[model samples]
Target: MFDYSKLITGDMPGDKIQIGDSHIKRSDTVFPILLKKVKASGKTKIVISVYGGSGVGKSEIGSLLATRFRSNGYGAYVLSGDNYPYRIPAENDRERENRFRYGGLSAIAESDGFCSDWMDIVHDAWLSGADADPELAEKYEFMRDYQEAGKTALSAFLCTPEEIDFGLVNRIIKKFKHGEKQISLKRMGRAPEELYFESVDFSSTKILIIEWTHGNNSALEGVDFPVFLYSTPEQTLEHRISRARDKGVDSPFTSIVLEIEQQKLNEQAQTASITIGKDGELIV
Candidate 1:
């Protein structure tokens, strides 16, 4: 059952709220501030990104925030980050390896035969690493290192933001922002066989809510409200374990992936507008 009371508040206390053993009060402290920001933005259409490391409650909090938006008389839609992957789960591993070995975007395009000007730029930037193109090098150096690392090190490099279909995601968001009435979105079910597309009615949707670890990036540009949750790898272990069990996918590999994901996600936190602490308290 969902807790509605937790999603609403009269006034926020400076200190943490104790609810049984849970000291996290994100719903009370964070949601209210977000609501105010949405209302004050004065934009008929708004995009909110709830981003953080794995098992940090991005999906749950995003859903709650969307409900809050709807309750406040705004039409809202929640976009799943999982749907933006460049390839299906099974193929992504191969793709990541290709990217690391062959030179980022160039390698991916050559093998896949799906070339793009954007990819060309990315490829050039990566090769120009630390020379004249410091920015591009910085962006892609990790990918180069990943390619050179052993199989054991590869697990940590998998599923980073570089693997997402950023171009597709950006296009979808732009279309919606431009008042596109209808859009098709991919929804991944529990299994790969369940992947399917559903047409969404964005005709009246005033707010688009996207929650993912990599939300604070160029791919999600133009988002009106961006929320970053701060949770260390230690803090995330319990939630990750529970989620994995529920998904029937608890394993050593998943644990390693989550640890690496935490490291990458923490690096992206600096790009967020609002940062929430591990205790669910807002950090000024």
Candidate 2:
């Protein structure tokens, strides 16, 4: 129940206008207003998951939605499923080998500056020994023994057209996670540059678009007002093709692989839904 008196008396943070699910136009109006109201009340903490199989434009959709919220002066978060803490060099090699075996280099791993930064966080966390349970540490030490070999294999894998090192990423994640190391302020001092924040500030109704690896169902299990997109495999292919063309990519096979990826995405979207209006209201 919104306080109508607040709006009439110029005491409201913002007006709340309910919108219907099928009414896309109303969504455009109500969302921003409701955001203002939520922010005024200091109760902004919304999480909207956009999950689907790889290549299904999940990231694209999530990114766009986040952009929309940000444009309305909302602090939006755009997270991806692929943002896993993988080891570098070694992880790169393993991915290339797998890509090679699976006909071609379609499903390659991603390694960018952001990924490197995240890997550093995982490494720092491991070094801090935050999760050293003895058994995990023993396993991690064993993996470290083959670091040199893994690095070598990963180095060679970077020659492909896809770009970046994946093995080094995997090893980083493996050691940081299952691997057991204890880090103390005395030993490691501070947290990684990226992992410094204690928590996200959602005082204002901020929009968060999270792309989960486990088909969003895993992430949106109990979330309220979740919006799911329904795109078919063919539609996904067309979407990617359109994206590649927009990005100025002219490879035929690359386009084909993207199409296959679309099929995977269609599967994921079939299981998701979203809130189109303010407070899940029906504003015609």
Candidate 3:
């Protein structure tokens, strides 16, 4: 049995709003439930994903879950989704720009069944001088902006499952499942200039925990248990602002990005085995 008491903490104002001390409340509430589910699944190797939008307390809850599993005599490892990015910060900016421009165009062309030659013409028009025809110019501008907006909307989240180094994540998970004793990972940092290597000893590890906003993905096919935490945009914004204040930084853009991320993340909730609502209530 898991020690539920360790996950509890003192009451705080944020708990009422489901942000600060709520991680402890939710984790404690969910620990035994998750443990029972894992045991019932009958899987020798267990993988759990705690996923939610920004400021939804994924890392904190994931850590608490790992502790619970460890105390129960299970070897557990916690992996951060932040440590897996398609590119470093500097390179990612350029990549996003390119993906937004070219990727959107390609998607448009494919969706419309436009031949390469026709796409080339449209592409040229977009790059060439302004059109003399007002209607044509308006159409071109609308298409350009539409594509840019679509990509911008998705990129705002910074790292989606598509952007993660799933190849490495899968490899690590596979090694653990195969009973590998230790593994080294090239972990990513919050900034482009920062990156470091770390090794994990998984010799006795029976459960692997991965948490991220985009943790719900096909790449992680064999997750024994998946937990999805949900929070409204208003609550998320409040939590994000509070966190930013604590960090001594101001980020107005975070609100805009999180608004989009919240919608995307909600759609992913269906993929989870367990879901928790904004009030820290479990949703069956």
- TM-scores across all candidates? 0.67, 0.35, 0.70
Better of 1 and 2 by lDDT: 1
Residue 206 displacement (Å), model 2: 3.5
lDDT per residue for candidate 2 within 166-256, as digits (tens), equals 3432242233223224211101111233221122233343444554433343222333233444444454455446554233232332333
Tens digits of lDDT, candidate 3, 17-116: 2334687788877788899998898877888888887677887788788887888877777777756777764565445445555655655565654455
Off by over 4 Å in 2: 1-44, 53-57, 70-73, 85-205, 212-215, 219-225, 242-271, 275-284
Worst 10 residues of 2 by lDDT: 6-15
lDDT score, candidate 1, position 214:
72
Steric collisions counted per model: 0, 35, 0
What ranking of all candidate models by lDDT puts the best one first?
Answer: 3, 1, 2
Each prediction's whole-model lDDT (CA): 0.62, 0.37, 0.66
RMSD from true fold, candidate 3: 8.2
Which ranges of candidate 1 are over 4 A from the true structure?
1-24, 90-148, 151-162, 245-256
Single out the weakest 10-residue window by summed lDDT for candidate 1.
Answer: 9-18
Cα lDDT of candidate 2 equals 0.37
